[model samples]
Target: MHHWKPPPPLSLSLRSCRFVLSFTPAPAMSASSSSEVAPTGPADAIYRDRILSSKLYFDVPPSKVPVIYSSSYDIAFFGIEKLHPFDSSKWGRICQFLIKEGFLDKKQTVEPLEASNDDLLVVHSESYLSSLKSSLNVAIIIEVPPVSLLPNCLVQNKVLYPFRKQVGGSILAAKLAKERGWAINIGGGFHHCSAEKGGGFCAYADISLCIQFAFVLLNISRVMIIDLDAHQGNGHEIDFSNDRRVYILDMYNAGIYPFDFEAKRYIDQKVELASGTKTKEYLDKLDEALEVARNNFNPELVVYNAGTDILDGDPLGRLKISPDGVTTRDEKVFRFARERNIPLLMLTSGGYMKSSARVIADSIINLSKKNLIALDSPLGRK
Candidate 1:
């Protein structure tokens, strides 16, 4: 197996590095037009304080696009991440394809700060963060048994640090979405983790953290979660179960992992697909589901967990969605938010295959070509 390494510095001239993205913020977005009264009480006050003090919510200049990613998002120490089915290096690979194909400029991509411990406290319990200090606990959470043998410091640096960076990206995506109408964080969607637990290869509750930060920082009350990963998004479901402000629409293979019946109760709309479901049936169900969701909730922001694991031959997804099907699936979701004038934040959730990166890049390219998202070089002229 090949060891993952950071891409070498490009040979671009200094003049080329100064290209700026001239994107116009979407007009008449209901999310930015109004604000929800912030929640009160001591616990909420603490959460709000942490969010207010976070450095993850920094301002981005027009020179950078809303696509957030970093080479540090890849986990590759000792190659132990290969023990699991996940592509640990998929985030960097996705950006590499977009850059090499000229669909995106590397200089235009935004790099996010890592989510600090206090920033994580916005959603996770202090005890839960402490639990991750044990290498064995983290190993179990990620499902990589070999990681347990490593020292906790190495595990922290190699595994959890990347996840924290992704968590930061997820949190920052909401702010960027509110400004740009849409934002894509190429390495997030840790949907199986809750405030107190992390499992199913999810080490952090990035989705929950993102939404919580949105509630406090973005001043949005009504939020909708469109989770299309092959597995149930139990993390955010549990986190937002008692809160009426967040609406969840989850479509997953009920026959798969993390069958949390308790968390399933919280989903406002759940579409469970059986194993071996094909592309046509999947897309048809998505159409009906999106329609039902539109009628059910008028959310200010939409968080889309677009997992490419549904592609044909993904062992974990257990579905038969084609490459084109994936592309169309993304377009439908982008249109769902763009047409409604709602800010949208998309997280590249759970596609574990090596081809998942290429598939995701193609889908983003298609979104740009269809005028769903504004990028630096949608026409690939640069």
Candidate 2:
């Protein structure tokens, strides 16, 4: 209902513009119906620096459309916020499978949680929150598809809790990174949310608000949001476009979702990698990303969106990167963050291909880990 004025105009190379997919909007749902569902995964994890790390709380549903705007399948799969209901078990199944593959620590498991209204206010409107409450009170017929990620704020206390939990994971991730050192939020990658509105595939006020809030609470000066989700961080790009304190490193395909509302910012970088880009070529492109992040944006605190869709064989992705390629990508990016001694915060932005998703998650986890990032739960910690 609100018209957003984009920041300044930023342009990518015309030659970089490659294939753009045509997708129709999924059927819309009444506000009340939207609140009743949850995404599938561990309830409150992905807040750590690892894939199976105690940070990711995956309640997201996977049935929604996979990530767009990339030629890389791993990039597209990493774009998936929630797993399909049918694929819900597949998430843990993938987790366990990774355990079998020696990729994940065998001790990890995910659970569920319902967040509070106060927790949600960090990113969403109070009106939307109240509406979600009233819907859950009346128990209206839930009509939306099980695969959808964005839910309406007009349902039961239980249904609406996932938003809070997901955001809580993001907020807590930022808080942990600020307090201890570094953290990764696996679920909350809502990079496209403007202050009041949600666009592109990003819904739910996740990382955007967390940092916006940290500017005050955490006193974060010169925070960097490095969005590698394969789509321009249109919402985030638009939000911090004019501000010099926050820099955006968005490496996404040109001319894609959220319709590119013509936004620009200081020290932002976007590189286009086309479909069927071989592993070595993508690695070369990553070197460009490294130069841009290090040389252009000398960040004190770096928020890394470790999207998993850059892999090959991703149903929703167009790029042809293999699992090893994705791992290498994570290594290069993580190494860059680690070597600089920059405090890092990360998230599993998007994902689809389950097996490859597990690999990317596990690989990054293997690299950027501290021995102390353990489960908050006493039993798990013990």
Candidate 3:
């Protein structure tokens, strides 16, 4: 398919922007082909440009230190409810830091998502799709307040279609990573959403959909998911359990989101992290988890859920990990996967701070840097 033109810049006071993206195989098209070219349109959006945009993009450190990550994406505003809220809330401090460094700017480019039925089917059901079309999407998923259940009226008619925008962002991030190598979505990692009913705090199975889409469209089989989110990667487990090729390292509270009352019959590899778990403990568990990924479910591409909510201050996070510790968690996950050339597709999951007035959006960007620099760079030196 031909790549489309990008959209315009954001209305917010921003300095710079980078296009978010995914990785997929370059169709028979040559490297120099215009189709093979990076994003262009309103502001030359690409995950690299946006992520690397640094302070101009957010209030974080200048991207000057040269971290890691770079991939194409169409997430501009694709993440359902995750985007606008993430930008304003406790993420302000991080945004200030980026601004101090010039990673972000008012002129940054942005765009919404576009998820197709074919992609949604990678993990969802047709009957469920019909239910979504009937606007039962959000309602079936969460009972939070009087939420609209469906997104906007236009696509809201098709329940999954609106949520597809968020799904499409993941698809774009993964495609950018697979094709160009290394992709990420500032928003996404809806792991609790299942094939039928969305669970816990999730409404869509993004990682599951992306993995299945990779299986069908990309024709790549045997995928692995390294879920380090504060919560269990339950959605992925239930979706890819029988496949065997897809393994899960779900490190979460034993009874948080999915509410594992007795047993979790769907999960492949589950790890219950005790509450108040600190950086050292989480890293130890992460190392063990990586060993599992490397030894057992060693697949071609590894879909990593780099959730930062595991940090100590995260409202939804039960663990007591710190900011540097959050970086460490990401460092361990990305290094382990990238060292072996395992294509990684990352999405930000649950992260709510006890102090909503001061969140750390930089943790997300920091992971993107590790995504880019951890390998060839001296940033994460021994």
Candidate 1 weakest ten by summed lDDT: 19-28
Looking at model 1, residue 372 earns an lDDT score of 85
Distance (Å) between predicted and true CA of 190, model 1?
Answer: 0.3
Clashing pairs in 1: none
The lDDT per prediction is 0.83, 0.48, 0.51
Model 2 residue 217 CA deviation (Å) reads: 2.5
Residues 178-265, candidate 1, lDDT per residue (tens digit)? 9888999999999988888888888888988888788778878788999999887878877776666778999988777767656777
Better of 1 and 2 by TM-score: 1
Structural similarity to truth (TM-score) of each candidate: 0.89, 0.64, 0.66
Clashes of 1: 0
Residue 210 CA displacement from its true place in model 1, Å: 0.6
Those runs of model 3 whose alpha carbons end farther than 4 Å from true positions after fitting are 1-100, 104-112, 133-140, 148-162, 261-263, 354-361, 364-382
Q: Write model 2 residue lDDT over 58-171, tens digit each, in one string.
A: 332222111111111111123232423112222344344445665344333322233355444544556754544443221221212332333333223223344445555665
lDDT of 3 by residue, 1-382 (tens): 0001213321221111212111221112221222222333433242224323222112212222222122221122234434222221222343344455555432231222456555455456667667655434554353332335335453353333434555666765554456534555545677876676565446677786676555434445666677777776656665654444555666776535555321244455667776788888877887887787677665656777766677675555568887777777776777777777766766766666533212334554565464543322223221
Cα-based lDDT at residue 260, candidate 1: 67
